[model samples]
Target: MKFSSIIYVLLVFSFLTMTALSIYYYLQIQQDKVKISQAVSSGTPLPDYHFALIGEELDHDYWRLVGKGAKQNETEYDVFVEYEGPERSNPEEQLKLLDKAIKKKVDGIIVQALNDEFTPLIDLAVGKGIPVITIDTDSPDSLRSAYIGTDNYAAGQLAGKALIEDTGGEAVVGIVTGRFNNTHHSLRVEGFRDVIEQEAGIDIVAIEESNIDRIGAEEKAHNMLTEHKEITALYGTSALDGTGISEAAESLDRQDLYVITFDTLEENLRLLEKGKVDALVEQQPWKMGHQSVKIMTDLINEKQVKKIHHTNSSIVRKQNLPYRQDLRGGRQ
Candidate 1:
């Protein structure tokens, strides 16, 4: 072919390829934006302070919302937030990230201390003059500056009460908790059991740990419901637990099964709307993130900082779906 003919053919091919790629992106995929960090270019002025905010599972929608909150006002506070975490829930991995942050000597850290093993590392960061703030989960014995996020015990009590009311004080409850070793989950279970035990009409038929994953939650919930056919309701004490339980219930064709779970994740809310999940424990992760940053800023500024701040939480049911638009957040 002549040079002009060849050039014309290549141009048409390139244009078609570009059009296909654009259509694929705009139609096939839903996109989301998350600020991972403020990259400081060489010779560029840095923010006044650097803060490392570590979370449980980076890909999880609830934690992503929490991270978003922490980074929302980064420019306003004049701080660079390095928000990061493992792709999945791994406490040991989170510990390693915290250690790395400490060695880097970031001005501050906001981390979810999942359990007792995290306490020592938390203290180590504090000893090195790095103000550490705990989020979501707390290391009670650690020398961290402040604690923020949900009051787990109270939230659990709320869940239990919500169940009792929904079930009319009579339910054979099967509990699907995040993890046995996770402190917040333990507290939530304890608080829930205390409230449930007080009511003679309700019985906790079985309890299982999900290891903070949907598959684990589903398998355990499915097994519990199958083995114990009398289980009238399920209480999931983690972000993804409700989704799993809902799936399990649907698979078993348990249309009358009542379900309550932690976090108002978008999927969970959708399940609530479909009547698969009866109630959701509302956690304002965005507020938790933003408020924790504000607290950390006060600490760095040498201003009076409160030792603890609990972000808002409530029990949400299908009746209130229209008013709870803020529950739609982060990548699912």
Candidate 2:
């Protein structure tokens, strides 16, 4: 009996020793990761933290605003935000950059999760102990740290409400959205549909996808107008959709057709000023960018942060254009 008790005590001590060693090594590994993140490069000290901001496209004006917003606080926060994306809106290319960012072991990642396929990469990043924040578009099913952008459904609802109020609830509606698979675009379309379905006078004549470019949007919008002559009001659920719709409307001699579009890009704002677009469902891409860096900084500092942060969304019209502040810097 005495021998058995002694053996049991010895085994317990050994187990505790192993546990302590494991914890020590784990802590040392974590410290090493921090050191790696802070390493000097080319004899210049690195920022306190390094973050990557990947968006849908590099050349897009709306995305440029997002990048501007993301880099707004680099100096203030003593952090560096590396912003890059594909020249065009390509999910595969975007995800490839995301995977590369993960492999590079960035301190944090802020990205636009284009579709459901982004889930695995986001989860992979989290699994590797790197934090991720979804910007503009979100992967709700993934273990993302937070999402910062418009409440897509609510923004769509706003568009529908604007259309109802502006057109006296008697619009023959047609939609040209960014993409069918993009969660935000789908939510926007769904919200618009739900609202339109409730109104008896409004009937949706046709719906199309823009593929998120001016040319595609123009083609889709032109085709919709030609095929569905009854389409009195056109809603474009992407940034360039409005511009395309405007050009399409003018080309078809349908300038009087009510047009609504997403975002307040320079082109959209120009169209709005000229009365080409009836209303703009404006999203704060700059704000989305700005808040992401702030949130990521907080996250890196071990601060508790909100899981979801919506920037802002509003309807801009010709009447209110004069009263609106200069969005040149997207300061608001």
Candidate 3:
């Protein structure tokens, strides 16, 4: 083939590729617009109150349980509940979804204010006369109508006490959490630190953030064990942390290391049954969802609701594992 012909063919191929890419992105934007339109449409059709629950990824087991509780009360309350959010803990994405819910003018919103940055958005929703409830995490500075979820500080205390008891109040501890800036995780860490530090013999050797990434948590756990050979206990502040810590502990043959974590995930429960995880701090996610809707409904009806509702948190160990029936959290 002639060199000029070859050059011309390459130019055509490049042009076509760029055109295809542009079209693909254009269609993606269009699709997102359609979804936003549908979300906003929920505001219409009077006589039906609409509520939006926006949080972490839809597939997350904890949020699934929350959604289940919300859905269960829909028929009883004569309201519509819609749940949607990014597939990961993205504050920016969460804010965008909140904006959509606000534009939709939904009667109420239940969200996770992962950090204080969400305060302004929550206030915006409240300023629009929409009741907002913070679940899983709370934003006190925001004008949210109610804060419903576990008392993270108390839950952290439970973790600390459990760890001290298991380790005989004398050991090196490592913590794996989702995000340092996360209000819930930070509070949990604070509670744990306060209680654990009270013991003169116990020491916190390392505290790392996994950012809720499974592999990252596992890698952090492994690194902690490698770096601090004296570490005798591990604590996971996020739901995903338990599984990752377990995997790392097993791979490194650190079964002697005591493991305690938050949440009641199936994987974590299995580890508990097998005596890998010493204890789990269980939060009532179902109650968080259920109460969020109820409180929002109360606010919409002009009925006063409590400013804060602290849900139940308990420690689950192997001995009382039979009562684990209620700890099953997920979508119905």
Candidate 4:
């Protein structure tokens, strides 16, 4: 009995020792990883800093511009940038792509923050020591390193101011937005309302949601005009909304109504030339893309970056339309 008890005690001691050694090695590995990350972030000359840009959709013209900007810096920054996103604008799919990027442990990430749904996921990436930058739109609640995009509220105010000026500050206006819950869209609507409502002569009689579809926006614009016959102007908050608004007003043979919108897409410019649309508030998407990568690289090198970086935009009207076209390479 004594001999058996001694053997059992020896075995128990052996097991405990092995467990302690395993835990110590695991902790040492974790500490090493953290040190490496810190070293890279501190500008300790590294060969490669892999960065990924995940956007709402893969095929959109705006996102394409963003990708172009991101790629332009690959040679200059000595980094690799991979662009990926859902085939369409689906937030859930966007989340999956973010997760994949996180799993791959990219050095940094630039994402289009479309909704609050991305907030927690962005936080997760930050927790994993991956720096995140929000582009175009923002995730205000997350620990993102920086935001590089247009001031949406200001853009909306520009739209309203253009309408008021075109109509002598007295016209019934209608509004069409991509989605009500979209942060940027809501901010734009608020800015427009704030400006338009300041003049009692300008009244917004109707507001509609288009889900960012050109056809749906056109139909909604047509219906809004029919329902509110007194409307003398329309504001579209999405890229497609401008063309839709112009088409709806022209279809009704009410070309007298003033129209304003966002972006300088080719379709919007055509309407501008025809005098169907009055003005377009152009967001600098290419700059947003380029700046996003620059800021992310800075963060990876343990450099300080502003939490918010607002790109410049301008109201493209008839006079400057041709100049803008030449600058954008005649592409929408």
Off by over 4 Å in 2: 1-44
The positional error of residue 52 in candidate 3, measured at the CA in angstroms, is 0.7
| Model 4: per-residue Cα lDDT at residue 114 | 88
lDDT of 4 by residue, 292-328 (tens): 7778888888887899999877788899965665536
> What TM-score would each prediction reach against the true structure?
0.86, 0.86, 0.86, 0.83
For model 3, how does the per-residue alpha-carbon lDDT over 43-154 read when each residue is reduced to its tens digit? 6433267899997768688888888888888877878787887887788888878977887688899999998788998999999988899998999888998899999999
lDDT of 3 at 254: 91
Better of 2 and 4 by TM-score: 2
Please tell me which predicted candidate would have the highest lDDT against the true structure. 2
lDDT for 161 in candidate 1 is: 89
**Candidate 2 displacement at residue 10 in angstroms:** 56
Expressed as tens digits, the lDDT of each residue in 255-324 for candidate 2 is: 6799999988777888888999999998899889999999998988899999999877999998887788
- List lDDT for all candidates, in order: 0.87, 0.89, 0.87, 0.84
TM-score of 2: 0.86
| RMSD, candidate 4, Å | 11.2
True-structure RMSD, every candidate:
12.3, 11.7, 6.9, 11.2
Worst 10 residues of 4 by lDDT: 323-332
lDDT of 3: 0.87
Query: Which one wins by TM-score: 3 or 4?
Result: 3
Cα distance off (Å), candidate 4, residue 48: 1.1
Pairs of residues clashing in candidate 1 = none
